[model samples]
Target chain A: MDVLRITFLRIVYSALLLAAVVVLNFVMIHLAPGDVADTIAQSMGGADAEILAQIRADYGLDQPFIVQLGQYIWKVLHFDLGSSYYYNRPVTELILERLPATLLLVITAQTLALVIGVVTGVFSARRPNGFLSHLVTIVAFFGHAAPVFWTGILLLIAFSLQIHWFPVGGMRDVTVTGGFWAHSFDVARHMVLPVFTLSTTFLALYSRLCRASMMETLGSDYVRTAKAKGLPMRSVVYKHALKNALSPVITLAGLQFSAVISGAVLVETVFSWPGLGTLAFQVIVARDTPTILGILFFSALIVIAGNLLTDLVQRLVDPRVRTGQ
Target chain B: MSFLLKVENLRIELRMRAGVAPVIDDLSFELAHGESISFVGESGCGKSMTALAIMGLLPEGIGRVASGKIWFDGEDLVAASPARLRHIRGNKIGMIFQEPMTSLNPVYSVGEQIAEVLREHQGLSRKAAWAEAIELLDAVRIPNPETRATAYPFEMSGGQRQRVMIAIALACKPKILIADEPTTALDVTVQAQIFDLLRDLRRQTGTSLIMITHDMGAVAEMAERMIVMYAGRKAEEGPVDKVIAHARHPYTQGLISCVPHLVAHLTEERQDLNEVPGIVPGLAEFGQGRCLFASRCARATERCLTTRPEEIAFSDVHRSACWHAEGM
Candidate 1:
């Protein structure tokens, strides 16, 4: 019952957060120098004053800022994000078309990063001064220092350009004519580079965090007590220490969800993958305010959802959270 | 051979940045079946380190038994393999720590923590182990054993957590139980209760206890024999009542007088409380050629500063290591 109430409260909190995100995003997009009107006329090879006015009036840009904000909020409440001037399609439809690919990429990378980080972290924490642990620390240090896009370009150069082991860009072979398995294999091959690039920085962070957290937990009085209980070393480390250590990592992963989404924009643009990231990049260049606002809203929603999932998992794993204390 | 546990000329070394120091210096003691012994000393006097050494739970890469043997039921623990030692720990021997609050995994239910021991040592099914855990909680006198079984350590009071720790330590009914200042973190009243519970449990289970404590009152109450340790060496050893009444070593006497006797406090005018001055020597000062406690001993003589005092036998069970033991 307590968990239910807390989750319900979180949902309510998320709704308020989404509203703020929408308003803030709307205001910020308007604050930028160019809007859809300027981009449209510029694309038309510099329109006359009347043509510019017609374009502004046509897309409701001629309205007052307050009036535009109110209409936008009303449209958002009705599950509408206005129409994209550049794409000549509804913003919601465009986002929906791209959302699945981004979700697949982000979720896959996140899961891979978390799993690899935790395993490597546990190994490093076991013998903190060992050669392998030192190697992990060095690798993590390098991973942290390199930016995501830079890492992507490097991997792209090495794996795709030199070895030709994987595809250079996009999510799959355009001419694939096999069944689900073959298609999936092709997609998986294509994902290797982008996903690896996206996960590297986060993987480094999580592993380092988990390593530190696990080391501290291993030294905790309780872990000693567990060992004294004649438990096998395996049980002492994993069953007793890992759960406590993972708590902080899980929290960090949730908080970093927004960064990961932003990171996807860069990775997707670099790879030319058909995702919201690429859509976001194109829309921003075109100053598509409606599409930009739509993407921001969805990104905020995903991040909020990610945080909620983390909270629920924390409650499941730690009873202290369940009691709402 | 008849003793449940025996330590012969034990020397434990701690590796420090500067050098290695013998933290537990040539200590020897024994525990018979169902007997209780207490090691009384101030913090950093190696009382807890002795207990950790016995359980083979010493700080890794730092503390190690440099020499001597820990004989438990005819096995030399110092020579035991890690796997064998693990089997002996919590199965043949169990231990409770000083801080109960941090000595339990905060994420697990206390019952689950207790159950883990049963499952690990006894190889009981999960359900059976869980049931046994509830019984253990009840045995420790935790209220509402049924509901409390699912409560995490954070939900419990310090005293209650200590009880849970005791329950975990005693879960397998090991032949020996080493309690490292188990009640120090509790309130005085709660401390009494825990001691009573420990005594009752020891009596019921016939488990030999080695209680590590700094409290003279606790030593008097919980131990049949008491060893007063100073600077990692046994300063005095005897029956608790005999030593408390006729403390031979200056350090032992200081420990005894440090506690304010209730009867004396009630009967006489209050005067300045008696206290032992100075501190336990640092690691660098340990295992010197001369007596380690000489700098702090009021009865220190010129000889005491230059020569380490050997144990002077007073009886079969009583001994004092001090130059002035004959006069005292």
Candidate 2:
């Protein structure tokens, strides 16, 4: 009953946050120096002044600010996000087409990073001063400190270019038409580098967070009590210490999820992957207001959902946090 | 052979960057089967460290048994392997710490916490452990064991949590129990209740207890034998009544007199409080040549400054580590 109420409250909070983000995003896009009119005419190789004015009015850009804002909000409420200025297609359809690809990369990368981070984290905590622990810390330190692009480019050069172990770019070979499994296998193979680059950087963050959190929990009074109970070291660390340590790690995961969405834009652009990240980059360059706002709206939901998941998970794992005590 | 636990010339050192400092220096004691012993002293006097050393729960990379023999169940614990030590720790010797709040994992239900020990040490199945846990909670006199079983640590009061801690500690029915100031964090009324519960449990189980506290009232009531610790060394040790009535060391006498006696008249002017004036020296001064308590001892002489005092036997059961022991 308590958890249910808290979760309901969180949903309400997330809705409010989403509403605020939407309004802010809409206002900021309008307040920027240029608009879709300029980019549209620029692509048309400098249209006549009268034609530029016609295009601006055609897209409702000439409406009063409040009128435009109301129309946009009402359109969104009716699930009819406006068409992309660049693609000249409905924004929803375009985003839906690209959503799965980005999710595939982000989810697969996030899952891989989180699992390895948590595992190596607990392992390093178990043997804090050992050679394995030391090696993990040093590597994670450099991995985290280095730029994500630097890490991606390095892996591309070494693994893809040098050894020729994986493909260089794109989801799969465009010409190689195949069955479901065959297509998925090809995509999975292509995923090796981008996913590796994405996962390793955050894997470093998770490991460091896990190690530090685990170390702190390891010194807790309950851990001492567990030891005095004659529990084996494995039970002491895993059953007793890991749950407490994972609390902070879970919160970090939420921040990482939203952070990774934006991060993916850069990596996707580099890899030429056909995902929402790539879509976001292209739309932003074209000053395509509808498509960009639609992407921002989706990103905001993902972040809100990520935060809600962690809050629920944290409450589930720790009764103290759940009861609000 | 009649003794359940024995320690001889035990020395524990904290390895510091500058030098090794002995926290417990050349301490020796013994506990007969089903007997209760108490170590009473001010904070940082190494009473708790001795408890940790015996339980093999000393902080890693910091504290180590420099030299000692903790003999229990025909095994020298100081020389015991990690595997052997694990076997001995919870199965034969149980320990409860000072604070009840932090001593329990807040995430676990109190019943689950108790059942955990039984499952680990006794190899009881989960169902049996849960049933036995409720029974143990009942034994500790916790009200409504069934409902309280599912309650988390935050749900319980201070005395109740300590009862849960004791329930966990005593679940395996170990031959010995080490309670490090188990009631210090509780209120005075709760303290009495916990003490009573401990006495009742000990009587029923016949488990030898090693109570570490600075509370003289607890020592006088619950302990049969008491060791007075001063600056990490035993100042005077004897039967509890003997030490309280005829304390040979000035530090011990000061500690005893400092507590306001209840028998004094309510109308009479309160006696000026007695205090042993200096502080317990830091780790750097541990195991030094002079008497560690000499600066605060009313009986201190020039000899007390230069030469460390050896144990002076008053009887087979009583002894004092003070140069002017007989005169006092």
Chain A TM-score of each model, in the order shown? 0.98, 0.96
How do the residues B1-328 of candidate 1 rate in per-residue lDDT, one tens digit apiece? Answer: 4888889999999999999999999999999999999999998989998888888888999899999999989999999999999998988899999999899998999989999899988999999999999999999999999899999999999999999999999999999999999998899999999999999999899999999999888888899999999888999999999998898899988887788755545667765669988888998998997888888887888999899899999998899999899999
Best by lDDT: 1
Interface RMSD of 1: 0.7
Q: Across residues B120-174, which tens digit of lDDT does each residue of candidate 2 receive?
A: 8888999999999999999999889989999999999988999999998899899
Model 2, clash count? 0
After superposition, which runs of candidate 1 have C-alpha atoms over 4 Å from their true positions? B263-267
Candidate 2 Cα errors over 4 Å, as ranges = A175-179
Spell out the clash pairs found in candidate 2: none
**Ten-residue segment with the worst summed lDDT in candidate 2 chain B?**
B260-269
Candidate 1: deviation at residue A302, Å?
A: 0.9
TM for every model, in the order presented, reads: 0.98, 0.96
- Among incorrect, acceptable, medium and high, the docking class of model 2 is high
Evaluated at residue A17, the lDDT of candidate 1 is 94
